[model samples]
Target chain A: MFDNIDKTDINELGEFGLIKHLTQTVELTQESSNKGIGDDAAVLDFSGYKTLISTDLLLENIHFDLRYVPLKHLGYKAVQVNLSDIYAMNGIASQITFSIGLSSKFPLEAIEEIYEGALIACKKYGVDLIGGDTSASAQGLVISVTSIGYAKEEKIAYRSGAQEGDLLCVSGDLGGAYVGLQLLEREKQIYLENPNIQPDLEGKDYIVERQLKPEARKDVIDLLAHLDITPTSMIDVSDGLASEILHICNASNVGCKLYEEKIPLDPMTYETAREFGLDPTVCALSGGEDYELLFTIPQADYDKVKGQLDISVIGYITEPAAGKEMISKSGHVHEIKAQGWNAFKNKS
Target chain B: MFDNIDKTDINELGEFGLIKHLTQTVELTQESSNKGIGDDAAVLDFSGYKTLISTDLLLENIHFDLRYVPLKHLGYKAVQVNLSDIYAMNGIASQITFSIGLSSKFPLEAIEEIYEGALIACKKYGVDLIGGDTSASAQGLVISVTSIGYAKEEKIAYRSGAQEGDLLCVSGDLGGAYVGLQLLEREKQIYLENPNIQPDLEGKDYIVERQLKPEARKDVIDLLAHLDITPTSMIDVSDGLASEILHICNASNVGCKLYEEKIPLDPMTYETAREFGLDPTVCALSGGEDYELLFTIPQADYDKVKGQLDISVIGYITEPAAGKEMISKSGHVHEIKAQGWNAFKNKS
Candidate 1:
């Protein structure tokens, strides 16, 4: 639908003019938003509930390959990543401030496309774009989003609240994003060597969408509330399942025992990993970018979430003296380790 | 002092390991911060008052030149720039989340130096470093900060509250930051041509510091509070005096008449402008990054702030029919236009 939009050079509109053009149609929908754009700062009144805040930075090449990633998906993913943090805390995402440092290479319409996707996400999630600042970059595009949320003081679930005997649960399936990335990389190489060859991604739409536009699992949070179950501790699985489990254990000063066979994985992801000559179990453990919430609940809450379509009971918390471990389907015990994505190592 | 510290490669530490090392010593002092780092999101409790939010993105090379700007000063200036917006809204900066995207070129110690400077600024401003994220970038450095503040419901200022016949006022001097930038660029070019020649910056400390370590006018906000004088409209002078005045006028649907002779300029700023063969008045009108507060008050409150040491009553708001104009020192009339920094044009 946006293919034929007029192309205007971003330079024709200065920073201020560009901001006006993008935000002129944004109508504030939140009762807490006292003021939105066109001010030194946005004013919000969250007098009844505790405020929650989170920030995430997304760089061009380090975070995603602009060569294959569409700008619209990139913008959508950026907002999703930050909102996932708020959801992981059992908070209602209310508003966000999205800032960008754009290079001159992006025309005004290109930026508008990114904004269109971001606004779509905001509308879907009922978030108000209260404030943001834009600037020029010397090189690639850079995006930083800060999400503001709220929850009752008693309803908030922190990562340091889990204890022994708590069941570990993860919302949504994992490893699909990683498998999808492999598909894209393979296609990219083929295109690089022979520009005329089309991508061989038929029937791989599930994994590809999982990689390009992962949702934040806000529905799972609401469902748990409706089911009258409160998790002891929670976090979003962004840096792979293993790394996130380690974070929860370290923060709560506890240990965990995960079952390799119980970790949720989509059938498409499993077959794709096999096709790529990779282990599906390892993909679920080490592959990142699955924005699923991982939490621990008491034994009494097991019946409340049992057989849920979106959640999986993966393991249980253990004493601190028992180091984190996992049990294989073949009845073998093994140490769990995190070999997830390390951004700095990629640069080095 | 840090020269002998361990020069650990950022790659070796990994993203999570590096964040733990850097933030191991951080302590949350704000009562509003219910939970700090080491969680999916930071929890805050802005219970009794309205919350204020603002964000800014700073990119290397586009916003600053490393040749003349120290990493420490750059970090300090980043915090200052964001806090200025809070004060402009008549609020006290309570907390900030500072995130950075770094490249492999920066070592662990270099990142530490930047954090140290940011901590110093936060300490000076009585704000807490609540949460942040670190990531790797493929290009130059990027810093994004989001500041949270609070103000009484009745005491907050907005850009759309100005009325005709209100007095226009400004805090501190203008144009020093722009001239300081010129001086630094000149010295940098000289050093590039002859590395051995030292920079000739003698007796220019005021303007140089203005550029390198500009402070947000929290004291001015406090003064206005103590004087029981709430501004009808307010904005910070990051985009020069003229642009800020225009923002107020546009938002408030009013016109303004600024007296050229009444605009404040440090004597050093005036001399430096003349030395560079530029007009001091024009510099004050179009130069940016001054980080001063421009506000308007009812004419009845004029006697209350008539002879303040740091404030100057520069003009008065006019009816929308009058249009925005500046009375030249030579008794000539000229329309005021915003020729401020255009980030996109700089790259184009």
Candidate 2:
């Protein structure tokens, strides 16, 4: 699929040579990093800080399709999603270990594209690429990333910390990634049906980029720290807005009322959803892969984030008796349920 | 393959339900583990110690053959191999995050069997299962494990610390895992040709266990600490004795002379090699997956570990000009070369 690229057989480099070639450019900048690649394990010093760890596994034909997704974008999105987990806990990511399994179908140059994207993400986020393993796969490509970070004990946020009467907030926009996927799949089908026609992705750059190269909401965490606001509960919006809200409610033994009209949606996402006969509200409520941060803070702390342009006050926490509900734009109250993104629909 | 077990559909539990069900019994026992599952990221307090992180990727049909390897054994062996990396650094493993991608061919019971074995290893090694991601694969099983641990700054060992006059030592016997693999493959071939035949595996339990259920050498680290002896360099023998010794030599800018007679070999491994018309010494030199610790220490510390039954002094380090060489039983000096394990030979 990577046309015009020199097809260097992966066997030419072998496992050790490939690893050394890929990691030769890594320059450790983290004070915590004592030793990196070329050892049995990476050594670090998280003295006086609580360490945070998160891992993710992405399998081809399951979590992603290489037909439309660029290898560079895939690597970048993978790192961002994992880093989002650390930021979701109000931590700063310091290092990441990435492991990949590839079939012989992949050339050395193809692997390099993926690692280049990964390194770009690490460099952009000021995170060190420490250690990882590479192996041959029996089928499609497989990627697994482990992100490590640190936070002060008092600054760490958990899902069970929300209290009644707290304001539920979200960062940036939602549903863009899900809408973007719809567009990509539609274009892929059209191309399969007619090879002569080019993909009509005009004016869809915003949502497409969101899907292919989403960034972790590290800035939001930094913003909260700068504002001296430690959120009572926080989670990244990786599983759609409604699902994340319900997670906070269930974990905290409370209820929530999310306002559909208040949910932020980029105009392009709404327009594309309408074009595809999909309800933009439903898309934002159920669509996933938006790496925005969702958090809850006490009502008294509202003034701290009220005027922040990137922050949105979308709902409020309620008593358990109230139940988890959503107020639609049409003035109807409905129970909020989680329709988690199922990437395994084809196989099952 | 798992006979006499209920084959509950994995889809019945969904992704979230399956994760909850599998991790329901995970009781965090480490003081370093401030928070584990049910969070965005696992929170660990390694405030006073340097942290060590290691990751490994295992792909079915590449790293293992499930026709003969049990699910539980695969799980246990996966954890042990990752932990062996931490122990190779002279560190105690404290936590592990395990991620697995499975095809729909697997039942919920099959997954539970794997997780059960993994949890057992964690309990036995006093490590906690903190966090991980689960997903569906399009083909065979894919497993990625990340092990975390800690050690005092002065107690950690690195491949670059070997000195010219350091004594080379190895723990446990070599060549057993490789021989075990040979026997299993032989049995598999026999069974495949004639299903009604009962494969002859009597009296081979030791080597078979070495291949299927190897253990990390945590006791050796504890013993070394008790004796107040710290090695100058160390590595786990996962890629054969020659490869590991060469790694130490290259990294430390030194050479070594390995004695064939001093290489510890279990009598079963030796006899099994002979039975297969393979040279026992060659197997010790090139057979991988032993999980034995190979280290180099100052010659002055030899008396401290001289009488230890598990510790064997195999050789001594020399100046770089001497080059890496191994002495045969007949006193013939031959240059030592690394024959690294290649699990991907079939694919690549």
* Candidate 2 positional error at A17, Å: 0.6
Candidate 1 lands at a TM-score of 0.98
Clashing pairs in 1: none
* Predictions in order: chain A TM-score: 0.97, 0.99
Q: lDDT, candidate 1, residue B158?
A: 92
lDDT of 1 by residue, B1-348 (tens): 235466768998999888888888778888898888889898999898999999999999999887878888988999999999999999999999989888877889888878888889999998988888899989888999999999998889899899999999999999999999999999999999999999999999999999999999999999998888999989999988889999999999999999999999999999999999989988888998999999999999998899798999999999998999999999999999988877887777
Residue A326, model 2, lDDT? 93
DockQ for candidate 2, C-alpha atoms: 0.79
Give me the candidate number with maximum lDDT. 2
Candidate 1 on A175-225: residue-level lDDT in tens? Answer: 999999999999999999998999898999999999999899899989999
The 0-to-1 C-alpha lDDT of every candidate, in the order given, reads: 0.91, 0.93
List runs of model 1 lying over 4 Å from the truth: A1-6, B1-6
Interface RMSD of each: 0.9, 1.2
Number of backbone-clashing residue pairs for each candidate, in the order shown: 0, 0
Q: What is the DockQ (computed on Cα atoms) for candidate 1?
A: 0.88
